[model samples]
Target chain A: MVERHEVRLSGSGGQGMLLAGIILAEAAILADKNAVQSQSYGPEARGGASRSEVVISNTDIDYPKVTQPEIFMALTQEAYNKYHHDLGPNALLVVDESLSLTDDLPEKSRVVRVPIIESATETLKRPIVANIVALGVLVGASSIVEHEFIEKAVLNRVPRGTEELNRRALDLGFQLAAGAVGGNK
Target chain B: MSPTVKLLQGNEACVEGALAAGVKFFAGYPITPSTEIAELLAERLPLVGGRFMQMEDEIASMAAVIGASLTGTKAMTATSGPGFSLKQENLGFAIFTEIPCVVVNVMRGGPSTGLPTSPAQGDVMQARWGTHGDHPVIAVYPASVPEAYELTIKAFNLSEKYRTPVIMLMDEVVGHMREKVELPDVPQIPIEERPRPTVSKENYLPYDNNQGDVPPLANFGDGYHFHVTGLTHDQTGFPTSAPAKAKVLYERLHRKIENNLDDILMWETKDMEDAEIGVLAYGSTARSAARAVSLAREQGIKAGLMRPITIWPFPEKLITQYASQLKSLVVAEMNLGQYVNEVERAAQGQVPIKRVLQANGELIRPDTILQAIMEVK
Candidate 1:
């Protein structure tokens, strides 16, 4: 059985959705699985909603984009509403609880409300790293890539000493992932 | 002089590679998506004693490239969609006369005046059949910055190797993206120049295949003064209506590429061994497809991606090999369905071939591909 998986992260541009996709893709590649990552935003750079998708496969991937995602992560109400109808029948969705989204979800789909923005602010004292918090939830949902690989990918991408803050955020993410996976005791 | 790689935009890399490949002449009209190629070349060529001129328009730019190439100098030109349309007639001339030159088409959206600043793979078939006629053309596409550099060098080699017009079908993303590209050392890149005939003016058959599939070209002032035209011709450089001679010349021109398919064909494959579903894409679109295949595999779906680095001549052999095991094949391109026909035809009746197409002047994103895969999933 081939392992084909996609993770889509949507939020306002500065929420680091694109960077999260890169980190995930890099982690998958570090795991030696075939991976592809891409992102986009509107004419606006900072405030406009941005989206990113990543694919990880045991074999070669044909279509690059995620037409339908099995797991979706949204950081803002606009992103949550934008991609609400795109969630597959059995897809898993992770969205910020603080964002007011009132849409009805598909029957086979499951929505997880996480305090991503609040959590990022509380732990790292910044709202920007909420993507990593959401990404932690994705790792909990789908073990597509190893968390250790993600840590190394983060270290490899960020500047020399920014690791301390990222490590704190990543440790919290590890806890979140464990929680999502039922504490895997 | 240095053995380093810099992640460069496709256009920047092409200019650097073109100059290093002994290209001393450049003439182009600046159009969106491809202007950086000319801009870089304009700045750098003069430093290397190369001639770089901005022509009045695309038609003149193409003509200037041909004119410079005929004089035994490695020459080139670049343009986007409408500029490519303007160069079609002369492109046919390059095919008929077998002039060795490279044309870089940094593809943008449209048939007429489409999205100028946007990216599109709409020119795949246009690069194949854009110039009206049954003549041979060599086309290559680069998915990333490094390949863009490597392939631009290869394009010059193919042009000189076969004495035909070679095209680099780079899109806006590759053309503009600036990354950390480690440029390779000069000695590492084995350069090949065109075979120039040593035979005197009296006995030179400009269309002769006996001198190899490509006859050694003699520059205009090389004491081998011979005529080159776009009409049907015989062995001598003169135009002729003789059917047998016309047939012979036509067959050889086509064979230079056909016979070298093994060497000319380039592609990349992902998870194809047991893939029930296959995606066939080229250029910028393939970047997304490569990721989607991996995602599909994680979800317990058997999928693989096939991206053609060489878009023309359509990698039929490669496609046929994967087509046998696939339940369905998808051809995703920027335009409506131009290249999808070739993919469908290559698959024969073996499986269902479909197109997940887009043309609203936007790059085909990863989400659209996930939707298509789930349809089959």
Candidate 2:
């Protein structure tokens, strides 16, 4: 298990990346690990740069903000361009399939591309669950927290009537990640 | 037995703390970093049979808090930098009249309307002297989410005990950060209510110091027809321009906090047994300083941390004691230089002081503080 893991999730405002970060941190806490989640965004309610960072550890967490993320997920090309440079060595970089990876990206870092938004919109028929789908993809790709804990946290956080939709979106995300990584884990 | 733990944002924990401390009324205007405190209270206060009011603006919100407290309700208001500035005049009013209330200033970058979403420690002096006059202020700052919960309760407790406005000085980082908090049972948390008059209604004096520095406060309409005013008042609570009466009132206002420093001052010292260098920090910056201290210890530097949970009343005695022992001190803060001046004053040139300052909206990283620690070492 990764003793301490830092995760960064970035997208435009209204994308619910902040909520996704909260759910991820909640999942870590449910697994009995220490976790902290923090976010930064422009004044705009939507369509501006939005980023959320979570740090999970088995020990006490100090310096709550993420400095270097070992696991990074960016849903938009703009976000990926803005934040992908600060990945830790041997970091796991997860991005939407629509974004292209640059050649100068960190050599030791592993990149996983999945159709997160597509899975939520096309498979689940709900664009709002894209954040949930992203959570699944990131967690499924990194195995940061146990899958059951993430599922529980997702159910606990999402709207009351949309549990089934979010559950499906999460499953689709895991499937997408599994397919992208050659079904290894 | 396993503790009941939950993932809570700092602002949410603050609301819980306020409720746990028996706060029954919230009056606030929505502002970033602090809006969540008001928002969560708006939802939860009514469920607990409490009152939540979003007044026309910050000034009115502060006034409303004073009004609620006058009626024997534990009241609070939350705001950011600009709003904190707007509430200062009334904050002074609350201070002068000795009204018990909590004002939460989630500090953001500012001289005026500055970075609304970014963190800063610029309000250190403001929390103490923002409200005009020579009144004593109690401002408690929390470095973590749990401390946020604990200190919010303490803020209310101190306010009620002192019959003064206590400032819960939170910054953007601690206000927005989410962490795992093992919440204690409601009945287990210590709650402090304002001291009520034991005397009969006809004999009650609002600002009477004969009983003690903090006289028992009688709630409005509690059969006690006592006057409270911003103007300097005597024991009878009437407006007085008499020099001797005003002097006694002002002296007592400061003496209440000064004499009770042992109770009001809260701080934490880590690894100071044989340390030659010390780091003094508060709020979120202290979190980084703690990590930096650990790292410095690993590198064979005898570094220690002194985190002041109670920002105002300044923790001078502790700083003086530590300064006498340490070779040098490093003060880390989100603002360029605010609390460092206080540290220098407290240290009194006994030791050299280094400041790890940042006001560009980003948190002061551990490495930056570590570098300062190295310099001091």
Q: What DockQ values do the models have?
A: 0.13, 0.83
Most lDDT-accurate candidate = 2
Once all C-alphas are superposed, what RMSD does model 2 give against the true structure? 2.0
Q: Which ten residues in a row have the lowest lDDT in candidate 2 chain A?
A: A176-185
**Interface RMSD values for all candidates:** 6.0, 0.9
Best by DockQ, which number?
2
What tens-digit string does per-residue lDDT give for candidate 1 at A59-81?
75544457678888888888777
> What is candidate 1's TM-score for chain B alone?
0.96
Best by TM-score: 2
